[model samples]
Target: MITNEYINRAIDYILNHIDEEITVEDISNYCCFSRYYFSRIFKMETGESIYEFIKRVRMERSAFRLKVEKDRSITDIGSAYGYSSSNYSSAFKKHHNMPPYKFRRSIVHKSMMNPVFRNTQTELLTWQECSEKITVEIFEDCTVIFERYKGSYGDLSVHWGAFLDKYKEYITEQTRILERSYDDPAITLPDKCLCDICIDAPAGCTLENICTIKGGRFAVYHFSGPVEHIYSAYQNLFSVWLPQSKYKIDDSYGFEIYKKTDCGSRHMDIDICIPVK
Candidate 1:
C-alpha cells in the first residue's frame, strides 16, 4: 500500500514544480521507491495515470490564472503553462469546451459565467497547486437530505436540480443550513458513480426529507476551479494522495461545497470530503 508520507511529499513536489516538466521517475525518486512499484501503487490508489494527473493539474492552474490575470492573452497564458502554441487551445476547448478569449471576456462583463464552475471553456485546463489543508471537525451523527442517481456526473444537472427543489422547501422551514456530498463511490470516474446530497440540521430537527449521514473521521480537501476539473482533485486524493494517506476510504458520499459569488470569491470553490476509517 502507498503510505501517507510518500503521497504528501509527492503532492508537495508537484505543487512546487507546476510550471515545469515532471515525470513519474521524478516522483518515484522523491519517494525513494522503484519506478515500477511506485507506478503500481499510484495507479491502484489514484484512478488516473501519473501523466494524466499532471496534465489535468496544469490545465486547472492555467484556467485559474487566465481568469485572475485578465491582461494576458490566451496564447501568453497557454505558453506560461508550457503550451507550445495557441493550438493548445484545442485541448483547452475539449476540457473546458470554450475558448480562453471568450472565457475571459465573459468574466469581464461581470456575468455569472464563472470560469471555475464552467465546464465548457476550451483550453487545456491548468491546476494551481493548492497546498492548503482543509479544516474538518468530527460530529457523531448529522442529518443530511440526499438523493441517489446512477449516471455520469456529466449528466447530473437534471437530477441535482430536482434535489435542490426538494431541499429548498425543507430549508424554508429551517433555521440554519449546511450542505455537502457523499461520494464514497467516487462518481467522477466510471468505475464508481454514486452521488448524494447532504445538509446539516439542528440536533432535534425533524428528519423530514433529511436522511442521517453518520459522521466519523473525515479528511477534507479544499480547491477552487471549474467543476469539470474536480476529477483531478479526486485523482490526486484517491489515486496518488490517498494511497499514501494513512486513512482508508469509508463508504458514504463525496459532496462539493459551492461558493456563491455573492457570499464567496467569484470563483467556484469546492471541497471534496470523504469518510475515512
Candidate 2:
C-alpha cells in the first residue's frame, strides 16, 4: 500500500504548482519514487491517473475564475492554468458541454432566472415565516484547511462527521468550524453542488487541502432552530430579504459558521454569512 505521507506530499506539490507545468515524472521525482511505481500507487489511491487529475483540477479552477472574474479575458484565464487558448477552449467545451464564452454567458442568464427571482412574489407573501433580523459586518480574510465534497446538500452531515473525525487532533478552542458552498443549490443540480467543510488553521500551517476565504463586506443572518429549517431561512434570505436590500450578493462562496449544536434536542445555532458588495 502507498503510505499517506507520500500521497500527501504529491497532493501538496500539485496544489502548490497548479499554475505551472507539471508532469508525472516531476511528481515522481518530488516523491523520490520511480515513475512507473508512483503512477500505479497514485492511481490506486486517487482513482485517477496523475495526468487526468491535473486536467480535471485545472478545468475546475478555470470554471470558477470564468464565473467570478468578469473583467478578465477568457484567453488570459486559460493561459494562467497552463493551457493554450485553442486547447483550453476545446478541452473546456468537451468537459462542460459548452464553450467558455457560452458558459460565462450562461452564468448571467441563470442568475436572472434563478429560483429567487421567479418566486419573489410568493416569497414576499410568506416572508413572515422566516422573518429574522440580518446584520451587516466587515469580515476579515481567513486561512482554512478544507475537505471538498460533492453531493446533495442534505448529505453534508455525513461529510462533516467524517471530516471532524479525521482532523480531530487539529481541533482547538480557537479553530472555527465552517462550511463553504460554492454553487447555489437553487441554480445547480443537487448532486453536482460543491461544498467544503473547513476549519480555520493558524498561519504557516501547511496541509493537504487549504484555501483562503476572501474578506469583505457580508450580510449575516442568525438562525437558531432545528437543522431542517435552515433551508427555509436561506430561501427567505435570498428570495425575500436580498432582493429588497441595498447590497448585491458577490461572487465569493457563502459560508455557515457553526456556533452550537445540541444532539439531544436536535437543534443547532449557526450564522449564515453571505458575501456582499
Worst 10 residues of 1 by lDDT: 182-191
TM accuracy, model 1: 0.43
The lDDT, on a scale of 0 to 1, for candidate 1 is: 0.55
RMSD of candidate 2 to the truth, in angstroms, is 7.1
Clashes of each: 35, 0
How do the predictions measure up, each by TM-score? 0.43, 0.58
Per-residue alpha-carbon lDDT of candidate 2 for residues 1-277, written as tens digits (9 for 90 to 100): 1235676568657755777899999999999999999999888876678888777766766776676566679999999898899999999998778889998877544443334233432222244443455788899999888876656777788778878898888889988999987555544556555577889987787785766778899888888877766665665676666656666676555899999988678599999998888
Best by lDDT: 2
Q: Which parts of model 2 have CA positions greater than 4 angstroms off?
A: 1-3, 108-154, 162-175, 178-257, 261-277
Which runs of model 1 end up more than 4 angstroms from their true locations?
Answer: 1-140, 172-192, 201-209, 251-253, 261-267
lDDT of 1 by residue, 1-277 (tens): 1224465456547745877888989988989999888777766655556676677667666765565444557788788778866666877776666777765555323322223234443232122232244445454666665554433555565565666676665554453333443221221233333344445555666654455556676667776765565655654554444444556554343455554322233254766666677
